[model samples]
Target: MTAKRRRFVRDNGLTLAFGMAFLLALTGQAFAGHAEFNNELAADGLAPIGLAAYLASSEFAVDVTENWQSEYLQFFLFILGTVWLLQRGSPESKEIDEAGPESDKEQRVGQYARADSPHWARTRDWRQTVYSRSLGLLMGGLFLLSWFAQAVAGSAAYNEQRLRQLQRPMGWGEYVLGADFWSRSLQNWQSELLAVASMAIFSVYLRQRGSPESKPVGTPHGATGVES
Candidate 1:
């Protein structure tokens, strides 16, 4: 590779790697889902859809958005919850005694902002307030949007199945409260919550040599919230 290209790849390896993996996974899902969907169509004596059609279908939309909503919900809760709650020995948490947002000086906002600080960090009004909570706000907003998309798409997909079975369709409100919606939502939610909980508890005892997510190998398990 060219020197410039090598440097660029090295600098962005993590994002590039995950981006490629995401594309590959999404492509695989499209193929596998299309096949599974065709099987259903076959059973019902309906024609199978084209790849483009399947990609635009409610089944695909709901499947994608359901997982997205759960992921964003996990991050939203973690971002907001960590502000007040903490686990003593987990690197995933703040110092045990340092719950809640700290002082403006500690955060380097307003008068405490350095020359290199973000413009909003130097502001003293509503802009600063908004910027201060922007992370949690963005995460929460994404969670809401994804969840809403999941509900809308899920309703359409569910209704299609109902029609296939010769049943009446449900309204949006009724469908959202029904077992199908809750089952999809709760299953994703349970997995996300378990992952978060596992990360917190596991970090308390585990050591990952060079990862920011874990304490240094030599660090005591009792050392609260210290990262490598």
Candidate 2:
């Protein structure tokens, strides 16, 4: 590889690794889900669908969107929550004494912005205001979009099963208000919340030598927000 390409990979190793892992895991899920779907079709005396057909089905769409929505919701809530809420000794949180948006000087925005600071960071107008909350906003927007997709796809899949059983298919409104949608949504939400809580609590007592997610090995338990 070229020097520049090597430097690029080294600088973005974490994101690149996770992005590749996500694709691999998704591929694995597709194959597994396709097999399970075909098994159900066989048991129902219906013809088995091809992998491409299964991938385009409402079942697959709903499954993918439900997980995507939940993950985005986790990030959205975490980004927003960490601003006002804090843990005493967790590296996952800011210092216990710091809560809410600090002054422009503290954030190095406006008059306090360094030469290398982003343009919006130096602005004193609405652009700065919007840019300040951009990350959380984007995550929240993605969550809403994916959750809507999950609901629509889940409704279609549910109605498909209903039609197969010779039952009446409900409207989208009814489907969204039904037990299945809430069950799917809440199950993922609970797990995501639990994970964030676990990470915060665990980081307070555990050490990871080089990971940003954990405190340094010799860091005291009372030390909050001291990343390695």
Candidate 3:
């Protein structure tokens, strides 16, 4: 590789690695879901769908969005919660004494912002207010959008199966309030929430050497937010 290319990769290795893995996992899910969907079609005496057809179908869309909504919801909650709530010992949390948004100087906003700080951070306007909460805001927005998409796509996929079974189709409102939609959403939500909880609790005692997610190996368990 060119020296510049190697430096670029080194600078962004974490994001690049996870991005590639996400694509690969999504591709695998598409193939696996397509096969499973075809089996359901065969059982219902319906023609099996092509891979492209399956990918474009409500089934695939609902499956993807349900998971996406939950994942985004996890980050949204974590970001907002960490602002005001804190754990005593977890590296995932701030120092126990520091709760709620700190002073402008601590955050380097307004007059405290350095010359190299973001433009919004240097402002005292609405833009600064917006930028301050931008990460959580974006995650919450994505969660709502994906959840809405899941509801719409899920309604279509559920009604399609109902029709296959000679049952009546449900309205969008009905499906969103129904058991299937809640079941799909809740299942993913529980898992993601559990993961966040585990990370926060376990990092209090666990060591991960050089990982920022964990405290230093020699750090005391009572120390909070001391990343390696």
Candidate 4:
């Protein structure tokens, strides 16, 4: 096979492998969720849902979406926040001198763009303007979408619980204002923030021999990305 074909196969194979792993983990979560859901139903003298029904249920959707939203939010906040926030000697951060958005030349936009650069990168239009900040924008968009998904799904799940308890089912607006929504959102968000904060601070004093997340074992704590 040609080098191009080999490279394509390697890249595609890795992507497919990761995709399969993701689906496998999701499927495992679904099955475990279904079992746990049915256990709760049994405890409450309610009928248990089948796997397919459980998969389609708001419970599953809300649980998945809550985690998804938190992850996206973490990335979105970290990506945007790291611009202004400095973490000394952490690989996840920009250096002290590199605060704020860099110049277009540094970002390879307009005249500094390569021949094969994206059309938007070369264009003198709104598309180019948006594309320039597209990474953070897309991350923020995904964070919003996932958060919205969590809200919608959480409302359904909350209503289900309410109905199970012979209580009134809430409207979307009411559900949004309810404590359940904020509790779910805040719990995941707090954990994500803690994790991100820990990583930033811990990497300053820690070293993992082969991990990209850490500086080299022998490297000084002040060193940034000196991976072994």
Q: Output the worst ten-in-a-row residue range by lDDT, candidate 2.
A: 37-46
Task: Tell me model 4's lDDT, rounded to 2 decimals.
Answer: 0.89
lDDT of each candidate versus the true structure: 0.94, 0.94, 0.96, 0.89
Error of 4 at 4 (Å): 7.3
Could you give candidate 1's per-residue lDDT for residues 1-228 as a string of tens digits?
999999999999999999999899999999999999999999999999999999999999999999999999999999888888898888889998899899999999999999999999899999999999999999999999999999999999999999999999999999998999999999999999999999999999999999999999998888887988
Q: Write the per-residue lDDT of candidate 4 for residues 103-125, one digit (tens) a residue.
A: 88888888788899998999867
Per-residue CA lDDT of candidate 2, range 100-213, in tens? 998889999999999999999999999899999999999999999999999999999999888878799999999999998999999999999999999999999988889988
Query: Clashes per prediction?
Result: 0, 0, 0, 0
Instruction: Answer with 1 or 4, whichever has the higher TM-score.
Output: 1
TM-score computed on alpha carbons, candidate 4: 0.89
Best by TM-score: 3
TM-scores for every predicted model: 0.96, 0.98, 0.99, 0.89
Error of 3 at 46 (Å): 1.0
- For model 2, what is the error of residue 139's alpha carbon versus the real structure, in angstroms, after optimal superposition? 0.5
